[model samples]
Target: MENWSENHNDFIDYERDEKNKKIHILIIYDISENKTRTKLVKFLLGYGYRVQKSAFEAIVTKSQLKKIIKNISNYLDEENDSIRIYRMYYDDVIIFGKNFSIEDEEIIII
Candidate 1:
């Protein structure tokens, strides 16, 4: 789904280590309206994001292809829009044999 994201074109040069897994997050919404907020949350949740309040997080062994479906839903809305992507170093230190390393990433909006 990242490819379908607004700034997806800008990620061409960036690289991720295939040996070390990482979690990528994308959040988009209109802070001024409840309808958009609700829609965004529903869409994320419908796509399996563990949502809590205004935030959602999820981790999986392999990238979920359903992610693109979630992103595409954003366009069905007629309101103006903005999207944010945050990639974080994912760690499962408590459980051995289960983990992924991530590079420092910034919140990107486009």
Candidate 2:
């Protein structure tokens, strides 16, 4: 298994140009400005669910991910804010937790 370093790109690349395949993404961030953080939260809600006060989980394609990253890069305070993104395929992860609910691209209409 290959690990990532600061000098290396750690993002995933599926064979056969699987840009349309949906994958899980975890986004965590910390911003010093309240207004910026709040705005970012609102923006991210369109793409995923908020799993924590400062963390979110999203299922998106490679193109959507690129767009999300690009949009957020504009206002991020690189010197005072920090953000991390982790991606995993459905079969690439194992979960062990308490009362965890899975969020898929499902629509529940009553």
Candidate 3:
């Protein structure tokens, strides 16, 4: 079998173009090791806003999502760590606290 990492670029490009739409992604992860968890959280902070201690929300393109997953996977211990990415439509996401909102056309990450 071919290695997934080897073919990921092609897959990312094709799917990104075909699905050229913005998506709301919620990332949640649990890591037992402090160093790894800190590294993962810092990495994620570069891509999204932290909504909670261990959760984040971002408006991302398909390509960005693919990249995020591929990069974050490197920090995970397959047997001990867990990461959950939830994809939701913009309109389908409802927020009830802190007035959190995602822009339709863009996300300005400072």
Which predicted model would earn the best lDDT?
A: 3
Best first by lDDT, ranked? 3, 2, 1
lDDT scores in order: 0.44, 0.69, 0.72
The all-Cα superposition gives candidate 3 an RMSD in Å to the true structure of 4.1
Compared with the true structure, what per-residue lDDT tens digits does model 3 show for residues 16-96? 345656657788999989999999888887777888888888877766777786677777898898888776556676677
Kindly provide the TM-score of model 1 when superposed on the true structure, using C-alpha atoms.
Answer: 0.45
Error of 2 at 66 (Å): 1.0
* 42-103 per-residue lDDT for model 2 (tens digits): 88888888877888888876666666766775547988998787775655656676434446
TM-score result, candidate 3: 0.71
Which is the winner by TM-score between candidate 1 and candidate 3? 3
TM-scores of the models, in the order given:
0.45, 0.71, 0.71
Q: Weakest 10 consecutive residues, lDDT, candidate 2?
A: 1-10
State how far residue 109 of model 2 sits from its true place (Å).
Answer: 18
| Candidate number with the higher lDDT (1 or 3) | 3
| Per-prediction backbone clash count | 0, 0, 0
